[model samples]
Structure formats: C-alpha cells, structure tokens
Target: RRSVRHAYCQLCDEAFRSQDTLRMHLKGEHQDRYCDTCDQARLLPSSLFGSDYALKEHHVQSPRHAYCQYCDRHFRTHEVLRQHYREHYVQSPAHAYCQRCNMHFPSGAALFDHYRTMHY
Candidate 1:
C-alpha cells in the first residue's frame, strides 16, 4: 500500500500535491486583490481598502461589463450574456430559441430534438 501526501491551502482549505499548484490556488481563489477587469493590473495594498474599490469602480465604468435590466444581473462579456440568455430565457418552455442557427422552437423538447438531429 502507498500513502500519498498532499499540500493543503490554509486559506481555502483545498489540497494540492505541489507548491506551484498551491501558489496558483492562492492567486486565483484567495487573492482577489487585483482588478480582473483591468487585465490583472497590480494594485497597491497600502491604498484605501486595496483593489476591491478599484474592481468595483471598473465594473461600474467599464463598457465590457453588460447588465440585464430584466433579470437585474451583470455579465462580464457579451458571450457570457448570450449564455445567460440561452440558459434563463431561451431554454424555458415559453421561449425556446435554438442556439446553433438562431431558430425559434415552440418547445424545449423540440429544440433538443432539433439539436440532436440537426446538430449532432
């Protein structure tokens, strides 16, 4: 029998086998201390409340951030908005819209069948 040891992240309580993996976890999961909207631009930790305020400001001002008034939701990209639309509105029985060819289906089953037959 072999016993394997894993390096665990104290901040997120997740385990990894390597220091590089742990470092990546810390950067991605725990360190939200940079503005993602600004292409991971570095911020000064000594400033007022660090980068959280900058991230919020960027989200508010950036045109890339899209807002859905109907759902009161925000998306980072238009592609994400399209995905949200398809998931929430188009996939619903009342409004079935085909994602592939931009066709409208009367029902979700019809859309699924169309995808299975035409797409698949």
Candidate 2:
C-alpha cells in the first residue's frame, strides 16, 4: 500500500495534495473575515462565521480600514479611498456640470464628448 502526503488545514480540518490548494482554501474561505491585528500575529480565521456585523464593527474600530460615509463603503487603505473619491466624486463632477466649458451638459458623456471635440 502507498501513502500520499497532503497539506492539512487545522481550522477547517480539510486536506489538499498541494500546499497551494490549502493556501487558496484559507484565503478564500477564512481570510474574508480576518482581523488585521490578529492576521499580523499569524492568527487565521479571526472572526466567527456568519458574523458580518462583527467584522464590520472590527473594521470600524480599527485604523487600517478606511470608511467612506458619503458612499457607505469601506476601503483597505487611504490611497484606495482617495482613488474612489477622485473617480466617483471629484473627477466625474456633477451629472450636468462641465469643467472645461464651464457650462452644463445633459449628460456626463456629452460633457466628455464636448471636451474631446471642442477643447482637445
């Protein structure tokens, strides 16, 4: 009889033939609700299952996650939050206001087309 060695996950009691598969399982199933502090300390699957509110509360209490009140979204970092703000709030502008022509357009695409044709 031949025996096969496999990587085992202690958290879920799952085993895989390859380490990569075990890692993928950990990341996909467990890391989604992980705690930043606990994760830094090598703690896997920090939050309990079916505790999304608890996870959200943890993020709100922690400084690592950036929360946007306007959009009601959470970002992992300040750079991501800035990028989101620029994309959805600042660069796009209001639906009708055009930055280049200093006028109002019926739609944002129309303003973009005006800028492309008239300004550019």
Candidate 3:
C-alpha cells in the first residue's frame, strides 16, 4: 500500500500526510459547515461515499411485522409468537391409555412404569 503524501481538504484546502488528520481538521475547523458525523471518523483509504445512512435510519424507526400485546415485544415468526405466549401459562403433556395393553395412566411416566412392571 502506498502512503498518502498530502491530503487536501476540499472545504479548507489544508494539507496533511494522513486522511485522519484531514478529517480531524475538517471536523474541528468547520463544524458549522460540515454536516457529517465526526464521532465515527474513518481512517482507512476507502470511499466513504458509498454508505447508505438513510436505510439504517429507516430500519430503526419502522415497526416490526409481528407484535405481541401480552409481552409488548415484536417477533418475526408465528412459532416464535406462540412460544412467547406460552411463557405466561403452565404447560403439561396430555396422556391416555395404551391401546395395546389396556393399561391406564394419567402421565407418560406412570404409563411407562405400569407397562414395564406388568408386561416386561
């Protein structure tokens, strides 16, 4: 990579060996005239001209597609929305009698124990 000899500020015509030094000069010297954000100064030798600041601003301000009134949060999918709503309620697995042996149990654990003792 070639070193930058002298960078001239288009606004003030001041010259420096580095672009960082020029940016500082522009930020400090002409704060009222320059509209760019000075806090995030770029030092790399690439064009700052290609960045899209408006798109970033739009994404931050826009409302999300899925919104939950219960949790007061936004999700991107239906499964996520359903799972989030379940957090407020207690969930238990439904159980029934095993058709093969006519053994009855209210929960899976009880059914497994009954089957193991009676059949196996």
Candidate 4:
C-alpha cells in the first residue's frame, strides 16, 4: 500500500500534494511579493496575472527610478546623488584635478578607484 501525504500553507490555508509546492504557494502567491496589486485574494482569481504584473513590469522597463530627467540616468539612492554632483563640479573647472591621472571623477569613490589602479 502507498501512503498519501498532504502539505498545507498557513497563510492561505491552501493545500498541496508536496510540501515544497505548498511552501512556494505561501512565499509567492500569498505573500504578494511578486505583484503588489494581486496581493488581494478577494479579487478575481484569473488564470492570467493582471495589474500587479503590469506595474512591476513597468518599473523594470524604466531604467531610472530616482531619475534626473536632464541626464536620463537613474540613481540607486540619495548617496549616489552626491556622487553624481561631483561629476558636474569637476567639469566646472573650479575643483582641483588629481595629480597623477589628470582625469576627473564624479564622486570620491570614483576618484579612489582611479587613483588606486591608474596611479599605482
């Protein structure tokens, strides 16, 4: 005789034949981690995923989240903002150039990397 096993998801009370499948359900579907709008279970459960997918897809398509419209580049965070400004400051000709390379860098991090490899 063969034994039958059932796996349960605590969040949605959904059951699956395998524990791994049930875990995936809890993590992906119930958690709303993938698509934010689809998080609502009361809404229609279409075989096709809807708005949630669309929103995430749109965010991915646009490269710039914290975007400078003039530069057409997206920044990872606020600290990057400071770094990017350095690029502008140096080009203004007021800032001192590095002694070794005579090349300008936008941020201290960029300048550090240039000095370490190029100068050394």
TM per model?
0.31, 0.40, 0.27, 0.23
Question: How many clashes (backbone N, Cα, C below 3 Å) per candidate?
Answer: 0, 0, 0, 1
Work out how many backbone clashes candidate 1 has.
Answer: 0
- The number of the candidate with the highest lDDT is 2
Order of candidate numbers by lDDT, starting with the best? 2, 1, 3, 4
In terms of TM-score, the best-performing candidate is 2
Sorted on TM-score, best first, the list reads: 2, 1, 3, 4
Q: Give the TM-score of candidate 4.
A: 0.23
Q: Cα deviation of 46 in candidate 2 (Å)?
A: 10
Indicate the residue-level lDDT of 85 in model 1: 66
Candidate 2 lDDT by residue in tens digits, 30-115: 76544543342123445453366666566566677786534447877789888876676456657445554467765555665665
- Candidate 4: list runs displaced more than 4 Å: 1-64, 89-120
**Candidate 1 per-residue C-alpha lDDT over 1-120 given as tens digits, one digit per residue, 9 for 90 to 100:** 854548776644678878667667667875665334333433345532245455555555667676443344667787987787677666676656566577878876676677668865
In angstroms, how far off is 22's CA in candidate 2? 4.5
How much does each candidate deviate from the true structure in C-alpha RMSD?
A: 13.3, 11.8, 20.0, 13.8
lDDT of 3 by residue, 10-92 (tens): 75566789877777786787543432432233333352322444323322344433444322355666577667545432232
Candidate 2 Cα deviation (angstroms), residue 102? 28
Tens-digit lDDT track for model 4 on 1-120?
855659765545666889667656755775442322222232335422346544444334544344332233446764775576466433444343454556766555565566557753
